[model samples]
Target: MDWIDWGDAPTWLGAVFAAAAAGAAVWTLKSQRDQIDEQRRFIAEQSMNLGLERQALLAAAQERHEAQARKIRLYPQAPTYVQVVNDSDDPIYDVHCEARGMPALHAVELAPSEGVGAGILADLVQGASRPYVHRLGVGREAWFHVVTNERGAVHIRFTDAAGNKWVCDDAGGLHEAGA
Candidate 1:
């Protein structure tokens, strides 16, 4: 405390400090803006990935039952009946066959065909075929229903091996129940 000396203090020191402080502030703001932009890009990329993942899951779910449905076939073997064949390696349950837009059977008795006694077959084993006739006739009810010239005139409803219900149209289009 005896003496204080400031005779050699540099005059430009204060200005240098101010300039450095302003430069540091600008650099910090730029860095913050860059970080924000990167975060936005990352969020957008993740959102797109999530959307793609959802689409893939949906596709897989839809195809799960199609393989079994493809094995169910309806071939028109006669005017009064079509053959129902289960060509798969697994059994299907609750099969139903119906005739739509069918013509009159003038030579045979035409009535509501009880396709396997109740318009429903409890189960059809693999490689089994039945006749399904609608005009007091029969199939592979593993046969039932009549022939029609119209598109999608005959359709089959059944439960697959996995217990999933399905429909096979005359056009051979397969769809899951309630879809």
Candidate 2:
């Protein structure tokens, strides 16, 4: 009997090639997944850093605003006497005080009825004196006077004819005129 000639290749060659292809496909998929995960992690890190930077900037700005607000709130508003020492020997002295949180003194009218401008400091320095007689005239006891003592330093205090006293300095705001 005549038998047909068979190819010299192994019967399992096709199956082996198919298995290798499947394995390579799985490995390629895993590698792609790993790359995608790394990209996602980098994006997340950048976002977190950006958020932190924004928070820090906002906090710094808020701190500065609060400090300025505190300064404005604490600054004196009532009649305040500020003595400035000039370094230059310029004969023309400049007395400059910004109203800041206080009402502008330029438009203020110190009348007897106001009960605020009768003080000697307002009348003498500001030239805003009224005709009404002071219950306690301007003197050592007046509640508004700046006196230059024997020393080069200047002294200022508020004294009422009724013997009320008030003084201002680094210690703190003036003690009540009568206190």
Among all windows of 10 consecutive residues in model 1, the one with the lowest summed lDDT is 103-112
Instruction: Name model 1 segments beyond 4 Å from true.
Output: 1-12, 101-141, 145-151
Per-residue lDDT tens digits for candidate 1, residues 100-164, read 74432211122234434322322322212343322221222255444442455777677877788
lDDT (Cα atoms) of all candidates against the true structure: 0.59, 0.37
RMSD of 2: 15.4
TM-score of 2: 0.38
Off by over 4 Å in 2: 1-11, 61-73, 76-102, 106-120, 123-179
- The C-alpha TM-scores of every prediction are 0.63, 0.38
The candidate maximizing TM-score is 1
Count clashes in each candidate, considering only residues at least 3 apart in sequence or on different chains.
Answer: 21, 4
